[model samples]
Target: MAAASIFAVIIFVAMFLLIVLDKIERHIVTLGCGALTLIVVFGICMRSGKAILGTLAVGDFFKKDFWYQVTESESKGINWATIIFIAGMMIMVEGMAKAGFFRWLCMKIAYMVKCRTIPIFITFMIMSAVLSMFIDSITVIMFLAAVTIELAQLLKFNPVPMILSEIFCANLGGSATMCGDPPNIIVGTSLGFSFFDFLTNTGLIAGICLIVSVVFFYFVFRKEIVTENGAEVDMSKFPNPSEAITNKKDFITSSIIFGMAVILLVSHSATHLTVASIGLFIAVITLISAGKDALSLLKKVDYKTVLFFIGLFIVVGGLEETGILEYIAQFIESISHGNVMLMIAIILWISALASAFVDNIPFAATMVPVIQSLASTSGVDISTLAWALSIGTDIGGSATPIGASANVVGTSVAAKNGYPIGWGKYCAKLAPATIIVLAISTAYIFVRYL
Candidate 1:
């Protein structure tokens, strides 16, 4: 217990630092840290007894035992369904990327914004945010960043503001839908919130934030953009705008499948099917359609992220098993005197600050069970807390250059195009706008859900 506690603390601190620095590859850092966590957990498992570890049936973590003890008692560690679902989603994203869908999409967006830099910038940000509500923020950032670089050079403007705004909007947009962000997906899967529930509640907040972000960005970058000569921009130089794409047919097919998959996700309550099962169905259809090429596409998915998620869950599981999480939740509840609204506020603010300095994915992963336990005891709605955490962690990414993967990737792409987005400058352009919009979102959550 002592060893596990100390190890968790160290890993938590290191992960937070790594995310805030934004210098290293997050997947790589997560892999390293996840491996270390497994090592520590295996040690604890060995010290306790083989029977305790043996009792850890592969699929049992999905059951009531998720909150069980680990003192040489029978235990389980992994959620196989979650692991498989993540693996499948990664493959699907890769398949789409390989099919030249993203590039084509980017080209189309670029064309629509042509010769009108500010409108183009605003339109891209708005659309990117909307796309993020359906797809992963990381994927959206990858596509937008690539196009923003080309558009930046052609327009003779900095890509920093537009890229920054897109990251801001991605978080906001993702907050609007259950499938939008990884944290929301975790919340949806664990708590059984349907897609419409998220859309109806958080979606409205997201729309408000989107409008707020646009207006905020206008003020932030109004001067730089207005001085630029938009008419002189040449669009033809950005050839094949779909250069990063590979297979168009597979792209279209996968997109249609993805759309159906989302519709099914949103209609979860009506169907009574698990997200994991839905993911499996998608994987099967994709494999049938793409065949050997589908298998090849699996390489594009970030498998490391899956492992990292598994490891984080196990680590948090260890905390729950050791009763550490329970203790913290109790401490928080007592401090707030069991006031659910106050508790929600504390969690939201803390999550935002912590997320700004930690990979929101892992941070959200570990917090799920913690918040679940907290809500179970305090009578607070876990769904609202989940949405709040998702909003904080997502939009908080825009508060700093190292805050989110999208910010890192977007800045990197911009730098390559000679418009470097330094930490200080990024903060100057993004922090105020993100803060304002996020504040509006938090207030909405408080008034509507609390």
Candidate 2:
């Protein structure tokens, strides 16, 4: 058992390194590693004659303990609710995008700030963050990046700084709400936290980070943000925001469905409906309203991200079955001398640094069980540790371009627009703000929870 557990840990670490290096497609790495884990753990169980099937078994392999273990891991490891919820949200966002809602919103904001270059920058940054609070940050960046690129071209200013600021703010904004980021959803649902709980707990800290990041970007980009005609541009050259809408009917329909989804998400505690169910319900309504375009909109949903998450859940589940996560919890507890504050601080900093390079979904999934174990052994409130992990993973991904989905989307958009932002340049520009926000979060955690 010890040898099998050690092997599982090694496989998991190798997978983590490959993911961080990003040399291959993430979904491929995750799925391949997950398969290897299942094989190794199943072989071990079979060899030990511990693979007995229970009364719930229905197939020929049901008599084998290996199959039972596999079933148990699959059931316990994957948070199907969170996965389905994200899928539904993605579908709805796809419908909205097809309707040009995001583009229209971006154009409206562009029109509002066209005359003031600095205000244009700040307004977009805030807009990116705020939009990400309800929608996915990557989608927010997809639309906002296009507008920022066009506006920069018109103003004859570099778009890199503005886009980078938007990316930073989008991630910060996501940390405020449960539906805002994948990591938040995984952590919140796993811990039974409500949307309002996240709003009350992490929302204020996210708002503070957004403000600080905007100020930071202002100072950094002030000199480079000059307009073509001395800080004021010809607004007539810009297209009207209303003209950006391509399908008014679909736009109205999507907006209504999306709004109802948000309302349901907020009232999920009272309604007794899982967030995933609400998202899926809205998605079905969207497809119906989309009429003949429903298939095309459905095709736009990010199935790759959803699959990657499922693969990660299975991979982490293997570790949990092997007792690797509990071992890590014990190691952390020993190092912290069972001090709750110190343990939380350690979890926060480690999660932040790890998430800066690795995907936070897997990191958060793995940490969820470890934090729960730590809480059980230490007799501290699990909610406090959960919040620390949530903030760390959610906000820490802002340190590098590879840290979060929004960062990757923003960078790709910039590169496609002939403003390729190098990893070193991205880190140099945004790492300080990331660190500052993290420090503020650490203080907030200590004051509010500890």
TM-score of 1: 0.85
Tens-digit lDDT track of model 1 for 141-231: 8888877776666667776777888888877788788777777776665665667878887788888888877887888776666426535
Query: lDDT (0-100) at residue 343 of candidate 2?
Result: 93
State each model's CA lDDT, in order: 0.70, 0.81
Q: Which stretches of candidate 2 lie over 4 Å from their true place?
A: 46-75, 229-231
Off by over 4 Å in 1: 1-57, 60-77, 230-248
Worst 10 residues of 2 by lDDT: 66-75
Model 1: number of backbone collisions: 3
**TM values, all candidates:** 0.85, 0.91
Look at candidate 1 and tell me the lDDT of residue 354: 74
